[model samples]
Target: MKKNFILLFLSASIIFFGCREKIVTVEAEKNTNKGGLLFKIDKVNAPKNVVMVEAILSRTDFDTVKASLNLVTETSADLALNNIPIGAWQLNVNAYDSLQAIVYAGETVVNVQDGIITQVNLTLIPTSSGLGSIYIYVNWGKIPTTAWNDFELNPILPSPISSTPPLRCNQPKVLYDDGKFKMWFATFKYGFAPNTGYAESYDGFAWNVVKENLFDLQKNDSSSYSRWDANCVIPGAVIKENGIYKMYYVGFINSSGEWHIGLAESKDGISWERYPEPVLKANSTEYQISAGDIIKINGVYFLYYSFRYNTISTMPVQFTGGISLATSTDGKTWKRSETNPILTKSQGWEVSRIYYPSVIVENDRYDMMYMDGSGTGFGMASSKDGYTWTKTTTRPIFTLADTKGAKAYEVVYPFCRKINNKYFLYYSSASNSDMLTITIRVAVK
Candidate 1:
């Protein structure tokens, strides 16, 4: 057999074609007392743009038995085989393109024993041998410690702890200024109807929460006129420019939760004043704005927010959407990006939604850590122009499983700040797997 390797493109549609190999089950036997072997696919070597591949395992004795694996990914996964009755086997893999044509092929031989696992490696060549040279790109960007760490620590004040554990708290926007770290977030006393709260810290660890809400559901509680932010308030981003503190926040009109981005200004970061109305509303009735983050590049303000499809099923749930862009000069009246939704959903952990973008602008690099879910994962993406983005990895940067602090049902709302060359990440996680008892937690790198 001609031996070579294949470029494994794991994202293609799998086709169940009839091969003459007479395939059998690849599943391992329960508590197998005899022969079995485990194979770890360590590398994906493939020609460019080949999106799918299949593997065939066969071993001939008095009779022939075969098993086929239809799909393989770039990520490493163990291919477990059990009860093989102790013998040598043939492993053949073929890479296919969208047209269901084989582009690359490789085969190898392995031995199986009573309790040992076998490993196989191969190099593939193009089916069209003279199709020039092939190039393969495997994206495996790992989150470095300098990027951020997944270490979890004790919660800050009014967190999962303090005087009374919060039943619900999230949308934490933390800012570092004048040798102190200040946080503005939302605390839920009436379910989704949250009230924005404030806290201060000198070192970003021990925190002091203000006794009262920062800017409540209204510009003032005494105002009887119905305001756009009357129902709920969630803090999004905070930036101080020209000695004035500007807070971009998410607001809700009623139980319908037509979320909009609103603004509030303060001098001392304690007492806040509102704009009386929302600064930005949804683009259409089919969409609902969730949260907004702000970044200033070359004296231009960039406000990026997340919006979701306004369906009946999604309205009742928490935030899940894609990140869109808008720009402003004075940081007030803004123009939407011509190419909106600069970042979007991906496969695996990010398939359901990508929202709550917290971006940091460092020179030419725009690093964004956003909420990636079905629930409990955060993803990172980088951009050069701030309009087009590429995900850092196929997986979440760090999950709640990396925290080892909260037994969380869902961990969302990532707001990141880089201070003194160290990254500070503040987000909410459920306390002990109880969704209602959500609170803020911090990690530093």
Candidate 2:
């Protein structure tokens, strides 16, 4: 009986040990099925001064897991997943708020192995916002910067001309004509002297003052008896027709201190003849209309200007100004396309005033340059169609840099011209005392 019991116990022990071995093999296979997952935040190409990286993970089993990871000194975030279960996982990463929300979220997926690290790399995008008020971009490819000839200490125009007192030259209108470049500019000079002037350039470097004090700011002998643009002609000239140079000049009278626009025409690029009647008149009881630059695209002429004080009696007030558009077929009679300002100062340096629009058609796109006091520099806006404009990234195309104790004030009227596959920007610069001095600079593509 004892011998029989011993043999039975041995057989039972063998069966139990064999079953345990099978269970161990199954667990080993399960462990091999999944590998380690590894991930990292790529910050090599990121902008400077980044703080933390915000990460989000999504999967079939989980909704979304979000976390803000601190960045190392290398501006990168390293993450490791050791012995992760075999499955698909998605990751999204963005920059932290302390970094000015500069980096955009990146997404990716990976499959993990038990002991293997599945490396996945991510790239972050830079943050961008709409342009504030003015937009200026240099097309250096077409117009090389090296092509711009340096100006003498006191250069003179190719043609003999005289220099007048520095006027408050603001809005600039430019066009190529008769193998020469011409600019019509406006200033804040009150009285009998013309507020708008004309300047000509052969190679867009040295300017020759063509017409100085060209417009008669005296009161017109009419029933209106309104002196056009008495206080100033902010933005001076617009090309109404191909050969006809029409200028929408601002006029203010001492009687009411109200501002209006006067229209004038020029053919030879110097002498201008003003229309006996004011092309656009301001409402005495309501807001006044101040005209800006006028541009023609595909035979459609658009007048972009501003309006202010459309309400009851108030002090000579400049309301939140905006850019408005007017359409004209014959370039004579114009009707307001929309009774609203197409573009206005919503934010940035131009938040206070967004006036003096200078537009140029490049690569079938309209690039408008204007000024903003908020930052005291120039900004840019783009428009596919002349009417609808999208404020682009407001980067100061030009700024007042102090040079030898003299500080530049503002960059007004940026005119772009291409020469020998290079682009040149002829702009007017002034000091804080409102001295009008034109500066010619070039940018290469």
Candidate 3:
């Protein structure tokens, strides 16, 4: 009886210790897999008497929540939530009044990497009518009354060093950073393939061209898969993030003759090394990808690009084109919006084509300047969210006639810049007499 009692006590202690060890191990694993969020809320078109805002982090399916927090305030406030399970989450926010009635609500998707504090921002949209209508304070102030100077910087940057006659200078993507002006432009010689070159300016007008190309075609046959961009590379958008200058461009495959969105990075805004393959491609066989503009918002990279059907039809003639959006966390991997083709051909002036998007977010609103491929003009549009757009009542903000007697018949590839409270629109203008020849021009407000 005594031996049996001692054995039973030993067995009970072993089981208890084993279970305790398992509990501690599971707790440590849970802590290791945790991440955090720093959230900022902006209330636009919100009702008065909003007393509290609650943020909930839920799974992708909206089936379960991982964590949540609340802030009581009448205005925008920043809050931090810690120790959420490291994974993908959708942030849902609800603005409540003193009566506990829901006033405004919104949700945005985000990815939480291990041991990282991902920043998120939510723009609240009201669930019901309110006192003040939601208005985006773009504050772009009066449109420029001043006529664009054709001579200010026509043919802004010269042709390539190896001069081929009838030089082509088009698709200007300029960056004003660190008190200096830099540009990545597409330069095409008469018979040679098109490539991207660099230029710099200290005063934003007088430019000194970099002698070499920033991006070029691969040195292989176009038919080879290795030569994805063996024919042409054109600059799309230029942005500086975390001290690194990144360029999103369009690369054409000679064999397929289809364009794809490509990426390249530089430290000095010149001398870029491109990735081996295109980062974004067409999911459908009937469309080809084109130039894209990228902007970072709430720790997510939003890329808006143009797509036209594979029919090779002409605008105002036969075919159609539209604008789409894709989001990325690291700016490499991308997920296309399910509701794509956000902006499509609609109005008479557009003529069935809308491509070459130059987009920026100002005052919690998205502003885009784009070209209608069939027309000789470009228009302006704005959005509260990046997905849906509304064209400005005064369409074709700038047109070929706006340049007056510049022989600029067609205007394409618009890039917008705002500095010192002034707005500047940079675009490529085609010669009215010679359609093949192109020049760069700028209009300032």
Candidate 4:
């Protein structure tokens, strides 16, 4: 009886050990299936006093946490966190000063796939109020650092393989939505025969030209006012209304020598059809419409454009006009504001001409970045109502000092877009080396 009892105990022990080994193997396999994250963080204005970093990761639902990491750092750090579960996660990173207070903070959402390492790049801005809203009148927040690249994209359709005069590209309209970053710009060779073109990118930095001349010059007719846009078509502001893309552009016949605003619609962001007549024309022969910015608020379209009373042969094109405002209910018929020119020449930097108004309405205020006719640089203004604008300062908000002249001849045509909670100001300029060739550049805040 004692021998049988010992044998039974040994058999039970062997089966239990076998089961334990199988469980260990399965657990190891599960660990190997996990994914990781490698984050490359760029500190926009990291203080010299920053001494450490605190990085935290949580599930997208905020119900569970993956990791809480702390590290000693200098001005900036490249952080790595591994073994994150395969799913969506939010990363909140903070840069701390010597006092252990958060000097800068940034957060971004990332997707981790099984057995894959996801790479993320982020620009961290300071949490201190010093980094955000500093203004006596118009609050522009902070000045941005410029991102200059040598990449160039030529006109897609009207570009001749070999032409007497080279083609030029300008006026970029950037949009990030539906999982893609898209741009629509104008390109023309010689003469004012401009057309709208398309380019796209997975990331905003590198661009791929998709289609050139998506919308070409409209058909010309006999009537002078009706034929105003026959020669060249340059798109100003593009927005989606009722599931369709609408573009407001300045159309002009170089021969007629006057410009007016026209409207076009597209089912897709690409391919467009123009309305038969100009939506907003120069009712007052005193001023002719030029390129402007448009935004929709409460189903009303606000159009802000520059205008010139008469063309001067010796005057530079950029300095011809000031900024004006008009409103449209259907984006077809429009009413010029009672106070027509909302913003005009107010300071020496403006050179008695202010145009290229880029307006962003935020927090019950209208924030505008505009270029003066001198092409010296841009200025900032704010308004409660779109009509009564208050210039932030007499100084130019963006300009190139004497030493920076080698970088760009002049900066004009400001456009602002916000991505990942960061503000990017896009504009066209000519480098001193290639003053005639216009190129696009960006400044990030």
* C-alpha RMSD between model 4 and the true structure: 18.9
Q: To one decimal, what is the Cα RMSD in angstroms of model 3 from the true structure?
A: 23.9
lDDT (10s digit) by residue, model 4, range 92-173: 6565667877655555565666744354433232222432110001011223344322212211112232245654567777
Model 4 residue 251 distance off true place after TM-score fit, in angstroms: 0.2
Q: Worst ten-residue run, lDDT, model 1?
A: 132-141
Ranked by lDDT from best down, the candidates are 1, 3, 4, 2
* Candidate 4 TM-score, true structure as reference: 0.62
Each model's RMSD to truth, in Å?
20.8, 25.3, 23.9, 18.9
For residues 1-445, could you state the per-residue lDDT of candidate 1 as single tens digits? Answer: 4423221112121112112233243443342434544433223323454655556657553234443333434353344444555556565666666677776555555555554433333333343343211212111112236444432333443432334434356778888888667888877764335777787654465455764366545444546237877776677788898888998888766746577888889898888888877778776732678655888888888898888865556546554568898888888788888787788897677867788898998878999988875666888899998888899878787676666343556668888888645568888877764466766777766
lDDT of 2 by residue, 326-398 (tens): 7877666777765456777765666676666667777889887676644366667898888788888665655
Candidate 4 ranges beyond 4 A from true positions: 1-166, 218-226, 311-320, 401-406, 432-434
In candidate 3, stretches whose alpha carbon ends up further than 4 angstroms from where it belongs are 1-155, 159-162, 218-225, 312-318
Query: What are the Cα lDDT values of the candidates?
Result: 0.62, 0.50, 0.62, 0.59
Those runs of model 1 whose alpha carbons end farther than 4 Å from true positions after fitting are 1-152, 157-167, 218-225, 312-320
lDDT of 3 by residue, 97-118 (tens): 7787775554555566674444
Worst 10 residues of 4 by lDDT: 8-17
Question: lDDT: which is higher, 1 or 2?
Answer: 1
- Candidate 1 CA-lDDT value: 0.62
Answer with 1 or 4, whichever has the higher lDDT.
Answer: 1
Per-model TM values vs. the true structure? 0.62, 0.55, 0.63, 0.62
